[model samples]
Target chain A: GAGVSQSPSNKVTEKGKDVELRCDPISGHTALYWYRQSLGQGLEFLIYFQGNSAPDKSGLPSDRFSAERTGGSVSTLTIQRTQQEDSAVYLCASSSRGGVGADTQYFGPGTRLTVL
Target chain B: AQSVTQLDSQVPVFEEAPVELRCNYSSSVSVYLFWYVQYPNQGLQLLLKYLSGSTLVKGINGFEAEFNKSQTSFHLRKPSVHISDTAEYFCAVSAPGNTGFQKLVFGTGTRLLVSP
Candidate 1:
């Protein structure tokens, strides 16, 4: 079976430009999440979507960061007016279900976003 | 809010030797614990998880972890490791009651280097 997948394995853009990262969750996975991993740092939660319910945006670092999952499968994280601080490996993950103890999340290879 | 701490930034050991990566978490509520491994140029993979029941949880690639509630720790241990075991390890925690989403808080990863 195919695991979660992300597009544009690497992206380099201007600091003021906007970038959109895409994620395709494993088929039938109802919960999806996005995270950021800076060099030599931990994975920072960004946002999450569970079924048709409201997406959990608490972990989003700022208003410039936003994500939307359409049809409960594919998700896109868009960063508006990217800053050099937004340079990092953007990772996406998905699980069969939602909730704290429901299932283990499988991760994608990630898209390395570099703001120059 | 929950947070995770990986005590060691890096651990180097000879092939076939025992190794341990320490992880501690802080949260006011009960949480689910997980260990993820990331090989170079690859995505993160689930090594193991501890949701409930037995304290010892076994994971892929001969890795295991023990959850200690009193110590607030979930350290990963492998009796014998291969050169392939050289990679990054991350510890994460997810608390309940988060609007049906399991948002993870991750620790700064520990880089494992196995030498012959």
Candidate 2:
């Protein structure tokens, strides 16, 4: 079976530019999430989608960060006016659940975004 | 809010040596614990999880983790590791049920280097 996957394995962009990272979760996964990993830093929570809805956006670092999941299948993380601080590996994950304990979340390869 | 800490950034070991990666998490509510492995150029793979029941959980590749509620720790240990075991390990925590919505708070990660 296909596992979670992400696009643009690596991305290089100028500061202040915008970038959109895509993720395709495992088939039938109803929950999608985004996270950031910076050098020497732990994985930072971003945002998540359950089914076609989003109940938690608190992890989003700033107003420029946003994410959406449509049809309860795929998800996209859009970083507006990207900054050097936003340079990191953007990882996506999905789960076969609407609730947490119902299923385990699977991760994707991740899109590495480098903002100059 | 929840946070995770991995005390070690890197651990180099000879093949067949025993290894331990420490992880600590802080949260106000009861949470589900997980350990994930990431090989080079790949996404995270679930190694093990502790939702309920036994405190000691076994996972693939001869890996195991002990969940200490009093210590709020989920430490990964592997005895007699293999060269193939070289990779990055991440510890994560998430609240259970709908509030979890698959959201995870992850540790910085511990890189395991198993050499022959």
TM-score of each: 0.95, 0.92
Question: Which candidate's DockQ is highest?
Answer: 1
Which consecutive 10 residues in model 1 chain B have the weakest lDDT in total? B95-104
Local lDDT at A102 for model 1: 44
Alpha-carbon local distance difference test for all models? 0.90, 0.85
- For the candidates in turn, chain A alone yields TM-scores of 0.94, 0.93
Give the Cα RMSD of candidate 1: 1.5
* Model 2 C-alpha lDDT per residue in residues A87-115, reported as the tens digit of each score: 89988888877466536788899998999
lDDT of 1 by residue, B1-116 (tens): 78899989999999999999999999988899999999997899999999899999999999999999999999999999999999999998986535666677889999999999
Q: How many residue pairs clash in each candidate?
A: 0, 0
Q: Top model by lDDT, which number? A: 1
User: Where in model 1 is the C-alpha error above 4 Å?
Assistant: none
DockQ each: 0.66, 0.59
- Residues A40-63 of candidate 1: C-alpha lDDT, one tens digit per residue: 556887777887554578878999
Local accuracy of candidate 2 as per-residue lDDT tens digits, B15-115: 98899999999988888899999999788899999989999999987899999999999999988999999999999887542454646777889899999
